[model samples]
Structure formats: C-alpha cells, structure tokens
Target: MNHLGSHKLNNVLGQILLAKRMGKTRVIAETGAGQHGVATAASAAKFGMKTYALFSENDQVAPVYSISAGLAYPGVGPEHAFFKDSGRVEYVAATDDEAVDALLLLTRKEGILPAIESSHAIAEAVKRAPQLSKDNIIIVNVSGRGDKDVAAIADYLEKRNTKNQE
Candidate 1:
C-alpha cells in the first residue's frame, strides 16, 4: 500500500476524534479525490459512527480507482467497507458549491462537524454556500507547499483586485 505522510491528515483525524468524543452523532466530509473521503469514512467506521462523504461532479479518476482497490482489500473490505453497496454514503453534487451546501446542510440538520479539504474550488464554494450560523469546521488539504501555488494565487488576487478597481 502506498502511504502518504501528512500533517494535514493527522490534524484532520484529531478533529474527527475530538468531535466523536464530544458525543457527536455523525461525521461529514467533502473530497475532491476521495482520498480524504475514504480516510474519513474508514475512521468513522472504526468508531462505529455513520459517515457521509460528499464529492463534486469532477472527482478525479484516481479516487474512483482507489475506492475500487480499497473495496478489494480482503478483510478490510467486509467490516470497514469504504464504498457502500448501494452507494448511499456517496453524494454527488453538480458543482463544488453544491457539494459544500450539501455538507453544510448535513451538518446543520444532523449537528455533525464536516471536514472539507481546501482547494481553489472550495474557496469559491465557501463564498457561495449558504450562511450557516452553527459552527462548522472546514479542513483544507494543502497538496503542494504554497511556493507552487503562490504564482497562481497571486495571479488570481491581481485579477480580482483589478476587477474591483474597475
């Protein structure tokens, strides 16, 4: 199994564990690649809690493949299955913003904290999603250090700045 060591992953699990200890009934998470989604789902199953994972329509190809592999794992597949037989645990939204809204609605209705990895798309979703008064925790997965994203971020910022000035 290919393992990825990341502080972000650790922090996300810590938050989920803390929420579970607080008597939360469920956990909701949004993922782009299904990495975080599968991880959260596995963790929730370990704790005997129901897990709900949200995915955008543009989910990368790798995640679907990973999910299939995860399901193929022998003993791991039966008890702690990542993919549901009926696909009930997976919710697909038309857009990233819709995914965020669905997650937020789940949290508001179920009183569960949702963990969402931060991406350029999610930033937009956060802005467009409905206002949720209840406290919701969003976990952002930083794939590459900002050194790689700085150029893109700066370009976006400059464009927005120019738009605002005009």
Candidate 2:
C-alpha cells in the first residue's frame, strides 16, 4: 500500500516472510548487461525455485574487483539507466583497496564489519563527507555480514602487501 514504509514493503516481498502469497517457482525475464539476469536468479532462489541461470548453486558471481555477489553484474538495468539519464542519480565508484580500507575503518571505529558491497558506499560517503556541511547525514546500507569476506579480504591485503614489497 502507499502508506506502508520501505521496511514493511520489503517484508511483504521477502519470500521468507510471505511465502504462501509471494513464493514463486518460475521467472520470465529479459536482460541486457546481465543485471536483470542476476536479479532474476536471486529472486528465483529466494522463492524456493530449484535453479537459476547457468550456476548450479544459484550463486551470484562477479568479477574479482566486485566480489559482492549481488553486485557482480556488468551494469545497472534500464530503470537505473533512465534515472541516470534524468539526472536523478549520480553513480560513482570505489577501488577494491578503498573499499577494504573503509571496511577496516568502520569496523575499528563503529565495531560493525559491513559487507564488502557496503564498503563501497562507506568509501563514497567518506569521499563526500568533507565537501558537505557537518549537519548533513549519509546513510550507507550495510547489507550483509562481513564475516564471510574476512578471509578473502585478508588474502587480498596480503597479496597487495607482498606486491608492494617487490
């Protein structure tokens, strides 16, 4: 409903919360640049569907730089493109090192080990914070737990350090 908040809407849409009503086993979708395919796959898995595109595990995969599974797609979808064209959104990027550094900073200061996907937002907020007035607020979605990424991040850092020493 129009009066429902975003959190409520998410709960209603989440298959776990409304399984009887919203659970679906099949999806028909068209994708370009792979974003819709990834989302469709994710949705299918969440709805207890047995399969997703290509991958046996229905796992979302991405290139090394974007180790965040959900965000591993090649580009934003049509709606996002429309938003960009309309100047409703300003897209920016963060390097793997920047995201890693931001992740560490947040963990050390706030005791929250945000997901690697979220670390990019943290990096962006950090970049823009100095330019904005002190009263402004920036909200970064820490979408998932960081524990799973700890080993990967550690290996990445170790490799980077070893390379720097060479």
Candidate 3:
C-alpha cells in the first residue's frame, strides 16, 4: 500500500510492453537493494521479457544491517550490464547517510516512513529540488513502508546520540 510501490510495477510493465511491441526481447534495470529488480523481473516475466538487474557490489554503510538483510548484493541481473553498455538505463549511487536523512525528513514532513531503498530516491530529489525552478514538477516513487526499519532506525539514532554526547 505504499505510495510508489505500484508505480514501480507500472513503470516496468510499461517498459517491457513497449520493448516487446518494438520486438525487443530483453529488459534490464538497476537497483540498490533489489526491490526494483524483483518488481522488474516479475513484470518482465509476465510479458515474456528476459529481465536482468544490476546491483551494487558494496552495500556496506551505516545501515549495514538493513542493507544486508534487505537489498545488498554483489552482482546485478545480467541484462542490466548489457543495458548499461547500450545506454538503456542510468545507474546512480546514494550513501547510507543520505538515505537515513531522507527517511527522517520524509517522516517528519509527510508523515511517511519510506523504505530505505525508496529513501535513496527521496535523497536524490531533495538534492535536485533546490536547483530547479519553483514551477518544476518532480515525482518520487516511495517504494514501501518503513515499519520494518523502525527498530534499526531507533538503534542508529541511539548510537548517533551517544556519539554526539561523547
């Protein structure tokens, strides 16, 4: 029921169907924690599109526990590599701190607890928002609920507080 959860599926379905209509058999995507990857794979499978996901090699960061349990990976889907070479999709990286900050900001402002993966997109948007004109429209996909991340976030904040006090 998260805001951007269905958007991912829709986007991937659109891409896969478009490529299929264009006679393309393969689809690829880049994901930080495999959320989009899983979605893309499912959609591609539905459309008979061969799917590949590209994942980051090093997901170790401040939220290592969440990353490891949720989306950390050493390799991406094979098709993602091919797409990267063909310029079909762009890859970007977000730091752990950026994600954490974005998560906090969105929670405080929008009252939404975004998944860590989705927080990366929010961080990117927050970075780009100030550079754009006031009338510019931006859409960010909030992929999932952050309920699962509550305990981890609490631990991280507690540690941060301890460090600040010391």
Best by TM-score: 2
Candidates 2 and 3, the one with greater lDDT: 3
Runs off by more than 4 Å, candidate 2:
1-65
TM-score of each: 0.35, 0.60, 0.57
lDDT digits (tens) for residues 9-54 of candidate 3: 6666666767777677777665654566677778778777787665
49-97 per-residue lDDT for model 2 (tens digits): 5333333244544433365565654433334444555689898988888
Q: Judged by lDDT relative to the true structure, which candidate is superior, 1 or 2?
A: 2
CA RMSD per model (angstroms): 13.6, 11.2, 9.6
How far does residue 107 in candidate 2 sit from its true spot (Å)?
0.4
Give the distance in Å from residue 99's predicted Cα in candidate 3 to where it truly belongs: 0.7
Would you list the rank order by lDDT, best first? 3, 2, 1
Model 1 residue pairs with clashes: 118-140
Q: Assess the local accuracy of residue 150 in candidate 3 as a C-alpha lDDT between 0 and 100.
A: 84
Better of 1 and 3 by lDDT: 3
User: lDDT (0-100) at residue 90 of candidate 2?
Assistant: 92
